[model samples]
Target: MAIFAKRALLSTGWANNLRVEIEGGRIAALHAETSAQTDDVSVDTLLPALANLHSHAFQRAMAGMTEYRMAGRDSFWTWRDLMYRFTTHLTPDQIQKIASLVYMEMQEAGYASVGEFHYLHHQPDGSPYDRLAELSDRIMAAAVETRIGLTHLPVLYSYAGVGKKPLETGQARFGNDVDRFCMLVDQAKDALGNLPEDCRVGIAPHSLRATCSGDLARVLATHGEGPVHIHIAEQPKEVSEVMAGLGARPVEWLLDNVHVDANWCLIHATHMTEDETQAMAASGAVAGLCPVTEANLGDGPFNGPTFLNAGGSFGVGSDSNVLISLTEELRTLEYSQRLRDLARNVMVVGEGSVGQTLYCGAAKGGAQALGRDAGVIAKGKLADLIAIDCQNPALCALTSEQLFDGLVFSAKDEVVTDVWSAGRHQVRGGRHVARDQIVSNYQRTMADLLAKL
Candidate 1:
């Protein structure tokens, strides 16, 4: 058994200096206002670690490379072209290296878990590897090496666009029929079964544009029992196309079609109407909001106050991995709300502090979206926690609300001094323990990929 003492911050509220005991990768007991004994381990401020509800780990390498001006207006579709070209040259080994680096950065940035929207399945030439799930195996390996809790979402990409169009060359690696996708998911489940129980498998139907209604239904029917994630209404163009092609807006059409619920995460519902937002909130689905990426991609601002008032749930993600910081993501989210409503602290719940409100809401939404019993420091919950450096100037005079505000608004990834996932210390002193080797491997892989590109 291991014991840790700190000012424990539960999702619902905060406690004074406390002692938490862990055994068999779960919290055994928690004692409030407990004095440390000679045998007890001591920590600083401890809070439940955040979960990145959406990510494409391989996209970490493509950060900042796609910001140049293209011929046209350079929308999300244009950015997709760059992403496709970049993804074409990656081998499983390269993917593992990059993913390890990304996951390490996430751990250091105070995210204990990641919901990886992994879709790269086949070789660049569109042929199956000797092991169909080789890429997923590499992702799982990376997560194990980095020690970040993983929700590996194997994405099903059957068609290129609406109406069952054939996948373009760039999308070949991500394409699989429903049956083949299910097979790959099973393979992934088997592979992940060898890892710690904190690692899980989920299904992602890439988007409304990528899969037809029948294909979506079949994939859901085959492997919809676990968490389900999908990109929806990220851009105005997408909303227009989805409406023009399907006779309904993306969110409206999805609500009419799928059984979206708490187990589902609707990524980037950025262009939802007020009615669509309200309906989404009532549907009990978590919105996988990536404010940094949305701003980077010019996807426009989400209706934060409207959605929040309508009882919408949301969790932040480092979607493109251009920037990976729990603090930055949360900050950008609140800042977006500020910019939208021209008001301060627009997301705060009743008499609740802004930082506490954001943290608690994201924790609950992220856990619900990932289908995990996490995001809370309570009995029977997974032991995923992050410790802030009390010595940091931003944390000076840290009350509960101030501590959260400092962590969310002022602190960067470097201030995350320690992190624990499943009662294991994966990060200490603001660094993943294996950062050197992981970063070295990533550098080599990135060098080779860049040389080829």
Candidate 2:
């Protein structure tokens, strides 16, 4: 496939009248000052699409159902109770439908890849499915139908909380001993035979509270070379629990014990101290920030300045699927930092465009977290890319340097006109090619699910 762009953000910098060539799911060549061919896809602007480095695809169905003011002092713990109850009624088919909708929205929003932190592994009663990787296979099926690059991170969730608490009834479907979890991971990896070559499996140890040190080490030992994600320091209560049970804060404990490197992605490190933030940045692990969901769940703002000053790498994700706008994800991240520090342009590394820094920095960091050889429009990289219509009202009259700023802060995702995942042109004219069927199936599935609820 050949894509001729009037303007494109290459890794080095922006250039005009460039043609990008893709072969074997990777960028094969680039020609400058190029003319568009009759069969080439012409675009106003092109950029490297980002990977959503942290997601719980099944949670997309629970978007607006948890907003009621229930009882005293609503908190993340209280929200978890409601979420746990909702998970019990989901079937494998329903899961697939919801995931399809989520992945479709992601592609439409200019994301070419996702890191699915999947944990709903068994029947509602906690028994393993006839195929141990049934749910994993369903997730893979959704990715296949949507044509999105996937890093399936099957979670090893052994305990309900810190101190190895026994699994609650609502948490049954997510539980697995170390041995069973490893087997499930292996089965999940084996089931990826039909997916695109860019699709692969990773491992997630749900949280420090969900698994002890010994079990975490065991699971990590098995998956030696892929991405590893975990939840950490999203709430003050969680921080207290990890401290009380594990004798250290979540990030501190993990950095002290585990050989955390570029392969690790610590999700929601929102409550770290200065020391912990510096240490985490020095370790080369990416901080997987989900600004929209963190705001929805009342999780505190990440210490962005501290982390960034320490040379940290970070990326944004649409966690909880409450909202899947890549524009909003980057906007909310920067806005959160501003609200915290009472300053403008707080997310930038230096005295340049905040939009470019946030957008490009996230692309690079998210690619690393998902183990994807993407994040930049460059030769020989995976052809994960998006094209935008600069003539859109939100972007009209903007200078080339200010284009990303407009996209990030001023535009919704509608400005996105095309998306290519590993050279697969699945989204065009700002819609996924399979949008109608996926939306129809999701609506039917939700109607049935709501009736059961």
Q: What TM-score, computed on C-alpha atoms, does each candidate reach?
A: 0.97, 0.99
- How many steric clashes does model 2 contain? 0
- By lDDT, who's the top model here? 2
* Model 2 lDDT tens row, 34-113: 79988999999999999999889989999888888977888888989898999999999999999999999999999999
Q: Per-residue lDDT tens digits of candidate 1, residues 103-217? A: 9999998888899999999999999999989999999999889888899999989887777889999998998988889899999999977678878899999999998898888
Per-model C-alpha RMSD: 1.4, 0.8
Task: Note the clash tally of each candidate.
Answer: 0, 0
List candidate 2 segments past 4 Å from native: none
Q: Which pairs, if any, clash in model 1?
A: none
